[model samples]
Target: MAAIWIAQETVDAAQGGDRQALESVLAGAQDQVHALARRILVDVEDAREATQEILILVLTKLSTFRGESAFSTWVYQIAVRYLVNAKKLRARDPGLTFEMFAADLENGLVADPPKAPDQDLLLNELRTSCTMAMLLCLTLDLRLAYVLGDIFELDHSEAATILEVTPAAFRKRLSRARSAVHAFTAQNCGLVNQSAPCSCPRRLPAAMASGRITLNDYPNSGEGADSFQAVKRRIGSVVDALKSYELFSAVPDHRCPDDIRHQLTEILSPNI
Candidate 1:
């Protein structure tokens, strides 16, 4: 599972000022890097900026990346370092906690999606945004640990190296983060527990009323990302019954966002 790292020769060539090689390396990793940043940062805009920063850093520090670890792990260290310093993490959602909503779910409330065709589309955006937003609720270090250990399925050793901690320490921290997510999601998220009160259809109006999403911006008949099928593909289909890493896997990569892809292309195009 851990074998999917950049080749040593590729790393060496890039570090040796092989422009095409550097571009190749950056291109290969940019989407995953962007996805990680999106989860680590508070919002999409911040994630986009952080991703661009990571792109530049990857190129600038290519020579410094010793091949002592997985190239992806090395890249994460740089991404997290930049996010820690550059990202002004948004304030935690005052009303956001799986525990708080858990009780409501336990009370046996069933809020189904409205009969409208766009209801499915809205729910997709809402749940995906909600999941990603939950990651931001954590402190920087814990957040990074959760993303690596649970979402990305990295081994304890690899994650520890990325965060520069002992394996034991990484395991302990990851346990805490994982437990928190599990407890909340298991109780409050419909996808995790069938008895949960919150369903995408149920939460759609509230999410839209607050301007978290727009119908015009997302339509069932739209094209590209706008088409209902397209939207579902980008934000994986909801199972309403996720287990373990299944929930995180359902969340799409951040670079899947077109704007971020455009930004990455603009930044890496000239240099790479």
Candidate 2:
């Protein structure tokens, strides 16, 4: 029921304050909520905190859900409202300009290849680090639009409903977002162009040193430098077929971390 839980009956039950149904709904929806928040928010820590708050907010507001939209769609609306506040509280963190990114390219950033094939941990780190940095580069509305349209692949009408915007407005926002990201990545990211000078591995040291990453804070997922290259590849190459957004999608999803997920589960479990 949680996985494909669009049945109006279950939604009605949950809305009616049925504890079990509410628990089931939240549990099933966790991954999606976590993923969206993580992408929109600044870091895992912020994302995790905001995710827990999002769940609680949804729990309290679920009763207000009018059922005019799909339950999942309604959930995203709540998620957006909660995250909007969270983003404002974040310290001013506009990322490098495209000119600076291009400078990194001209300066010839290089990726250090992972030693082994099973270094899934480093691959995870690389993907997370790069994607999070990229997301932080975007303005709030654009970031939200990009996540819903490009990463999550929400259609304009459905995404607009969740955003409370008309399809035309949503498309315009997404278009602006796509243009900004495409401009940067087409020249910078290896996922979009293998020949690009920067690679996740090469940037990893700087990120960790600068405290942009702190695997030490979380449960050891074996993402440390010597843990083998989780996504082991020796060289980058060009890919002509895929668009930049599709290339951006190649980065894996590192949703809200485990500790936060469990904390939420514990709080919501009794309700269930």
User: What TM-score against the true fold does each predicted structure earn?
Assistant: 0.76, 0.76
Clashing pairs for predicted structure model 2, backbone only: 119-228, 119-229, 119-230, 120-230
Model 1 agreement with the true structure over 1-272: per-residue lDDT tens digits: 12236777888887776766765676667777877876776465666667777878877777787777778888888987887777244342233455544453344333654555566566666666666766755656788899888888888888899888999989988888877777777666656665667755666666676677777563211222343334334334444333535656656554434554456445554554
Q: Cα lDDT for residue 87, model 1? A: 28
Q: Encode model 2's per-residue lDDT on 6-69: one tens digit a residue.
A: 5677767877767667766766677688778767764656677777888887777777878787
What TM-score should be assigned to candidate 1? 0.76
- Total clashing pairs in model 2: 4
User: How far in Å is the alpha carbon of 158 misplaced in model 2?
Assistant: 1.0
Looking at model 2, residue 238 earns an lDDT score of 30
Stretches of candidate 1 off by over 4 Å are 1-4, 87-113, 216-244, 256-272
**Runs in model 2 lying further than 4 Å from the true structure:** 1-4, 92-124, 204-243, 255-272
